[model samples]
Target: MLTNRQRNHIDVPTLTAVLVLMVLSLGVVYSASASWAYEKFGTSSRLLNSHLIKVLLGIGAMFVGMMLPYKIYQRLTKPALIAALVFLGITLVLGGEMKGATRWLHFGGMSFQPSEFAKFALLFHLCALVSTKQELMKDFKRGFIPVMIWVGLVSVFVLAQPNFSAGVMILALSIVVLYVGCARLSHLFLAAAAMLPVIAVYVLMAPYRRERIMMFLDGHSNGKPNYQLLQGIIGFGNGGLFGVGPGESRQRDFFLPESYGDFVFSIVGEEYGLIGTVLFMGLFLFIMLRGFRIAKYAQDDFGRLLALAITSTVTLYALVNASVALGILPTTGQPMPFVSYGGSSLIFSSFAIGVLLNISAFTDMHPREQKHGGQLSEAATRAAASDFGETSARPRPEGFVELSRDARPEGSVEPLNRAAGRQAGVGTVY
Candidate 1:
């Protein structure tokens, strides 16, 4: 049995934000998946049913993760990394491909994107390594070299799947974690420079990727990849300031491809409009801020690094998804955090949330100690005064109090009582 205080460890703001995203995801997935479901299963809500089932599973996973000690994750870091790598390797060998990319691993009647789990595992492992070996992190040989080699290996495997977006995400996340862990700026710059040629070659080899980049730079004329982008723009334009209404998106009627996944923002724009987008963005920003706060005040190095990695990964994904929908970046297969339709993405994101919640449990002030119903209002001076009072009241000499106070305070106006001190010093006021 869990007490209400224990359950409240789930950060209310973060949980609420995720729940809002989940509800929106369900709605958009129902709309976008309707056609596919009707065509395949003779029902419009088949995808919805599957999505609901996954949501339940995700919720269960999240609860478990929240309850588990963050220290346990530190212990499992190496194993998780190895397992993720093995899964990625298996995906390359036996994964299914769609659009010239093989990123999914299918087993039995179910399928999942291994890259998603890989991201989490990598974060976990990297956090453990960096946090545990802080002094070694500054050394190029002991610190960065090994991590870079592992990063290269991970990147190569992901690239072999031809998932450039996921590779980019992995690199971005790694860099962010390293940066937060206090890696040298020069190392980051050098790493970025090294990756340039690799990115160029990848883009040059893939004509579709090149064309997508060109289309992003120059407006689309053929209406192929541009079709969805155009619909997204229209959705925003029609939305004006407020919106049309919930579930009343004009773009979802076969105009936008992937209306529930990558382009779910457009549906949000169409139905809830500018206000909703702003609100959603605000929520995400709040999560990022809270996550950083957790990192800043973490109890240990591992907790700090874990919070940083998790927050950075989530923030990066949100940024990329938003950029794609706004036509600022080439469209990639990345899904919106909780707003996407995929089971794997949702479950993994939920798991990440669980990790964040766990961190929050340790970072936040204890509920019983909070002032004004969980508000952090205790002043340092007040706390110190209380401690001083308690210490003074304990069984000890009066001279000890004077010494302790003099040692602790930087400056004090009260003069030492010579007569009282002399009496205590002579007679021993214990």
Candidate 2:
């Protein structure tokens, strides 16, 4: 049901960038999963086919997110947060365990991690709260505490699931969002400092987690190079400068566990070498840069914050996953955003990018959109700015659009459409 006009409104370059990653994901997953599939299922393409299906479903989710108006998300923020909490609770009670962690729920032959959805939902809730309560952000009790409460609750549930990585990811993301929303750095620093001991205890208290840390520090076990890390390093070393060549990775032959999942980046290094690895990383870098530009030019504060938060989450996931594969950091089981072969990470990432594209559509005729036949018009500009206030002050600023930092919330009411459709603004939250 997509029209040319709507399609044209998408940010083509960012879309192209993500599409490239998705394509590479399919290729790498096929290559990395081939041996595993054959050994486990007597067929090489079984896992590849499954990953393809997930990719297709993820594409559908992405488009759905893109077509939905960003403001409707604002209106649904509260309910969405509640739903996320409920899902997390349900996951704790009924989730399936893998590798000693209960992080996934299976229904009707499909499974996904609730933490993925919770991460995005929390992002939405935080953006709404910070944008609407900008006035109270400087106040510890009124602004900071309220937002942190939601963050703390989410973190607690995720940690209770024994998913330390996800819990910490949410906590770190919340603090970053708070800082970006103009919360006092001193408060954030103190908060982080206070949480350190708790995080430390949580890590040290877990047998597996404590062992991983010790192994990381010792860098060896029983006078042997750590099996997983050694295999990954050998994979990269085998890649040398150019690579061993596509589909030629020796590591995928059962040397590396979960090559198609957590350590897929090492497979890339083994197959494509440094050149391919650089190109692969370059694609992610492009997404990050383009995502930030979208946030910079977003129509309103909420849109900007949402875009940035999404971008940060994806990039952080990529960074952490890659670092772990390279043995630069202790393994955290975080998957590479779009490249890892998993349903939840891929689907959630696709959905987030779709929302980013929707926000970019309103960037006062961003060149990327125009390349696809969208136009920039004064009417669109005015419509985009209406949420902030009547800005007859001057012509729309060139390039990226942003709201004034000092803009205050004016008490007024107007009938505003909280969707793609235009409506008169009741009262500007700014």
Candidate 3:
């Protein structure tokens, strides 16, 4: 049980990032969704209102996640992983398909994406497993094989849904966790080699996938696949150095499809400009650095693994999102952490931040000290006395007496008059 003082020692860098991103997201989402809202609901504020509600709900979920003891996650890891897999299966059976991908489960009016939660749950389980098997990680059979099988199962299911981007993200995330967990470099290299042919086949079999790669590498000749990329680039160009100003983006007005989802960065660049984009990039880098620092200084193996898993997951997602926005990779439906307009992504991001905060609580740079007000005051007083060259001239409390140099014997260097005290039957005085 962490005391209040102990809990306060937890660094909130991730939380700070979350707050900044949320504010930016809310403003941009409002602007990006306004035109669509007006067309659908006959009111421009409808999307903004709904997004505000989602933000409030996400914040509430974050509060719960951050307040829960990190140890509780250990107990819940197995169950959570199972539940995530079950939900993923359910999504395949009854999920809603959007843009030809079955990623969301719709119940009544609410749609939930299981993949978002699955990422976190998989992280939790992997961390727990790796922490317990540090020695085994170096062994191919006990460590690499099991983890690969586990990830492969999930990947097969995700790819079966034809959500190639999600599958790729999951595979990347698992590889990162394995690397951080100290799997042999040779094993990773071998695995990478093995994956190449499969990746080639997958790409060759899917015409759109292959087209995306070609368009990404060569720029579309007919500007068919490059339309979104060109629009995104134009958004950034229009803003110039400072920006066109918030809510003034011409691109978000039906010019950039799904501007509020994966390409929210375009809206950001269009509205906030080059400066804003740089700032956003800087914030994400700072967050990744902070999370790595937390993982590096975590107190125990479990904490270290947990921190690494969370940090890697967030970092990978951010990189993929940026790559997609920059047209270095095909655009996927992955949302920018905290900056995209989606309930599941936002909630999962908050949860990941919460885990990072939990790891921060146990860092060694801030050691646990006595927290009673009186004890702290006493320690401070003693420190101040030492600083001021004060001498102990008065009698002190029985258990709190201060020893003097002169209390030693004349010919001996012993500070305590042990011999004299023993002779006097008063026990050794110190």
Candidate 4:
């Protein structure tokens, strides 16, 4: 049912970039999962098959997200957010435990993590609220509290599940979004001051969390080199300049736990060496640049915020995962986006990118022929502006930001299809 009928409208390069990661993930996943699978299940490909199926299913989710009108998601934002909260509540009541934390729900032989979906549902809904409520963002009571309430609720639920790091990351991501939406800096600073102590207490109060913190602070606290962290570092050290070669990771042979999951980056380093690791890291950097460019040229404020939030969220998680694997940060159970073995994260992340691509499809970056494919026209450059939006292949001036369709200083709206009614001062806050 899903096809690429509107490929010309979307950002092909972004799509291809993600696809390359997913494809290469197949081999890396198999290499990392082989020993674990054979030890647990009599076969080496069990986890590989599982990861591959998730990748395929994620592709389908991506197409669905790409083909549908991104505006529809705005209309569905409220209900989607409510549904995510309900699912999170359900998870707490009846969810499976791993690593001593409750975060996943199994249904009909498939596992789902409500927090993954909640993270983006909160983001989409946040973008909706922030874009429409820009006028009120500077007010602490009227604007800030209302938006922060949603963020606080989702984060509380995640933390109650005992997922401290994810809860903190979700909260941090929302704060960044609020800051970018131009919420008053004073209010954010005051609010964070109030929350910092609570967060510190919460982290220190948990015995297990405290242990992890101590272990991170003192790797020899228990007189060992932090088994997991040391193994991961050894993986990187095994490959000095080049690599030990593909599928030749000694760490994967039961030395590193969950090599195909949270620590997959270490397996990558061990097998591909520094050259391949940098190339892999470079891909993420490239994706970030491309994502920001799309946001810069989005058709509207909501589109701009959505594109940036999604891209930044994925990149942040990837950064955290890699940092943990390299022992640069304390172990956080977050998986590498697209590359780690998981179902919910891959699907949700892919769907979010699909929406971003849909945003790009309406921008000047879209490859469609303006006067038949070569030149630019007014409509072709509508995503651009003298301000927040892009003007051409070249960049915009220094300090301009997003402008609402209803607030364009020129007081003109696009006289075309969707832009006519929607851009003609009609609000998009359905």
Candidate 5:
């Protein structure tokens, strides 16, 4: 039911970049998984077929996300977060384990990753909580602690699955969001200090976790990296200037672990070369900047925070995945968002992007022309003005903030109220 006319309201560049990455995933995932899939399933097409199905489903979900009002998620936050928590708990208790960790839920003959859903649920809820409690954010107990309780709960649940990387990423992302939402830096620092001991214990409680850290610290027995990382580095090195060409990777024959999933960037590097890798990373960079553009023009505080959270999560995961492949960090099992071959990551991330595009629809930061792309139709424009009227009405995801022209200097546009100087990200919402 989606059409090009409907897409005119969304951020075309970000959406285009996402589609490009998804399309690229088809080739990259197939190349990365072909050998392993053949050896494991007696056919190379098994994983490719599954990944293609997920990609198609992800695209559909993204469109659905674009059509829905993002505020609807605000109303659904409590229930959605509760459901996420329940699913995560169920996964921890009854989920299948692999490689000494449990991170998936099995139902109706399908495997789902609850952490993927959980992190986003937590993000939405936190945005709501922060927006609603802006007046109290500076109050440690009433504001900061209450917000942090959810973060800690979700992180603890994730860590209980023995997923240190996800747990840390959730915690770090939550902190960043809170900071952007105008929480006190001192409060963030205090909380981080308090959690260090707990984090240390979590790391030390598991032999493998401790070993991975030690390996990275000790340089894996006197300046050597882990085998997987070493092989991944080799893949990049072999790529030289212009890659070995698609599907011509030497690492795909059971050399780099999770070649299609965690270390898919290696396959890209090996096959497409440094030029290809940089170009691949350039897409995420574009996404990161465009997400900020959306946030800067978001109709409300909640939309700003959500855009920030969604963008940061995807791009940070990509950065970490690339870092691990380059042997600059320990392997953390992070997938490269749209580029990785996974059902849950691709689906949830695509949907989150949809929500972001929905927010973008309310802003002027759309395609450059009214006739060609992203113009607010006259009916929609009237509706947006009505939704945010006469400096009295509250902004929604369907409308943007209108700054007082008098307060800004000549030839300059002030994004937020001058009074909200430090709380730029928290503008007009609290």
Candidate 6:
């Protein structure tokens, strides 16, 4: 529902970061895809034009997400999850194969990967539950079981598609969001241990996956299975500290497969060298920090958790992709967020950024808000205000007591005044 004109409230800093990344993505995609596109389609502009269109569409999707109130996401959580489940199921049954994996569902003239939407849908549901059921989160039976059912439901279909990397991403994202949501750490550890065997079996059942793992562990031996990894490393090594120069990467000329998609980071390294890659990573780090800042000052619990989940997911994907490209991890077909030439990844990332900026817009970081000399901390005041009516004359919630703001900077985590809550016998409402 959000239109560009109405999205003035979008967080300018985060928006700036996203725009810069998108520009960089455009440049990289153009450079990285030229050779591959020219060879495949007999026209150098084919992939570049398609990438440009996807970028524009992604920007539009971002603005739409920014225009809508994030609270709407909470309402849509259940239906969105259900829809994703159905779509993933349909993809598993009837989807055509790409790269030996049935991960995309093709329609008349278009295609979509359901897992992309499902990722965000699942995160939205997790945030909604975490925000609404804070107290219950500490209990394994009541908290962990119900939430993880959705995680499992999504993961089963993703793994069934044999998209092992995406399956791992979904499970990892769920675990991280749950941890951030305050699920018991011990239970999480136990759950992870229990999952190891299942994960092993899943990996071994597929020869390619097992080979990938083995290659990852011992890439030095012959380097046959790790041809892609070796080629990527060679690209980076060729760049050295300064790089070979933008749009001049030799690796894109068929030496490294999928250079414009999953291995785009190698293109970045080969072209820009270590300095460029470092600066690129710094941008992602900036986004991560800015996102967490917005989460810290979010208007409510839902906003806080939602922002964190979205931020974590984006940063995690970027990090993992870069790691794989650098040979720090196994090849995982995970695309570099904004830098990769993938419509699904780009659009989903843009949408997440849009929601994050919206949340940031509602945060209380403005000088005017800080000028109000009330002793109550911003978070306590906001939460309590929501609990009671906005009007001060409304009866205060029973046992409610305001706590003074900590002397920390804006968007820093303030220690919960648990003593005050204990004295009030409310046992930490927010």
Worst 10 residues of 4 by lDDT: 409-418
lDDT of 4 by residue, 228-303 (tens): 9899999999977799999999999999999998999999999999997887788788889889988877766688
Residue pairs in steric clash, candidate 3?
none
TM-score of each: 0.83, 0.86, 0.83, 0.88, 0.86, 0.85
Screening candidate 6 with a backbone cut-off below 3 angstroms (N, C-alpha, C), the clashing residue pairs are: 2-67
Q: Over the stretch 302-369, how does candidate 1's per-residue lDDT look in tens digits?
A: 77778778887777788788878888888887987877778898898888888878877764323344
Model 4 accuracy (lDDT, Cα): 0.82
Per-residue lDDT over 1-430 for candidate 6, one digit per residue giving the tens place of the 0 to 100 score:
6454335445687788888888898888888888888888999888888888898989998887787789988878989899999999999899989878899889997788899999999988998876665555666776687788889899889999988889989999999887776667787888899878999899989877878888999984345757889899999999999999988999889899888888888888999999999988998999999988777667676788888888999899999999999888888998888779888888988998889988876654432233347676564466456445463523333333221124323233333345543453433221
Q: Taking the candidates one at a time, how many backbone clashes does each contain? A: 0, 4, 0, 1, 2, 1
lDDT by residue (tens digit), candidate 3, 170-265: 888888777766667788889889987886787788878878777888888356658888888889899889999999999888888878888888
| Candidate number with greatest TM-score | 4
lDDT of 3: 0.74
lDDT by candidate, in order shown: 0.74, 0.81, 0.74, 0.82, 0.82, 0.80
lDDT of 4 at 213: 83
Q: Candidate 5 — what's its lDDT?
A: 0.82
- The per-residue C-alpha lDDT of model 4 at residue 326 equals 83
Error of 2 at 181 (Å): 0.8
